[model samples]
Target: MKVPGTINSRNPNSQSVFENSFVKTLSIAVLMGIFLVDMGLGLFEIFSTKESPLPTAVVLLIFAVIFIAGMVFYEKQGLDTLSSLVGGALAGFGFSFVFVSLVGGVQFALGGGISTIGWDQVISAVAASMIASVVILKALSYKLQNHLY
Candidate 1:
């Protein structure tokens, strides 16, 4: 019989540093910061241009590199892959919503008290961030797993 509050020696894969609440919260916060900054920059580049595709491509490349690097680092730390990915997506969504709301508030405050912010853009940003993070995480995880084995 396994005793409570004792490590299960039979389960080698049961060890997870991310199981700690503090560590998991910190990880989510880190992911949120990363998504905020990365997606913020990408959104800026995207909205700054209406006739250019090069900037968008550059943003995608930058995000890809960052996501791959993060995945490798997290994998090395033995974080659960599914949890990490889900956290990433949630972080992305949160960041997108916050960023857009802030921008809208700023615009309302500065532009003669007029609200010109588009809700569609905010929604699109949230969706894009969530979808992109999930896809990127999956691809990187697959590649990393293959390389390790």
Candidate 2:
């Protein structure tokens, strides 16, 4: 009784459940939620704590999520590899810039009236994070290119 051009989820012979628009939108929303929550927690920890914001477990999780999502988007959108790399690298650099600045500011505020954090540390941390992000994302992107659905 299903229409020829309509999606029929109740029909056993219909397309995959994931092929539905709602499912796709929900999945994307969930992924975006994960990324947003992770960034929020990281920012909160950076400003409210004396510890480094770059927790290994948390950072690795974010990186994995970003890499997988980026690759999927790249494949779906037919994005140029070079543009993706550059865009991702710039994003990483911008994030690191903000993160390092907050960390440095916190350290300065908590140094008991002395500025313990120096520009060298901030520059080095930003550079290191930007380089690491680019390398990791590029490697993963290259390995997974055209291999994902």
lDDT of each: 0.54, 0.55
RMSD of each: 14.2, 15.4
Worst lDDT window (10 residues) for model 2?
108-117
Q: Write the per-residue lDDT of candidate 2 for residues 1-149, one digit (tens) a residue.
A: 66765765365677886999767655555544434333443455566665664565755555555555665566567778876665555555565545554544444445532223454554455555545555665687788995886
Q: Which candidate is the best by lDDT?
A: 2
1-149 per-residue lDDT for model 1 (tens digits): 88756866456566578788767655554565445544464445446543333344554555455555666666676878976665555554554445454454444335533224455555565556655655666688789998865
Model 2 spans with C-alpha error above 4 angstroms: 1-12, 55-91, 94-149
- Candidate 2, 79: how far from true, in Å? 15
Name the best candidate (by TM-score): 2
TM-score of each: 0.31, 0.33
Q: How high a TM-score does candidate 2 get?
A: 0.33
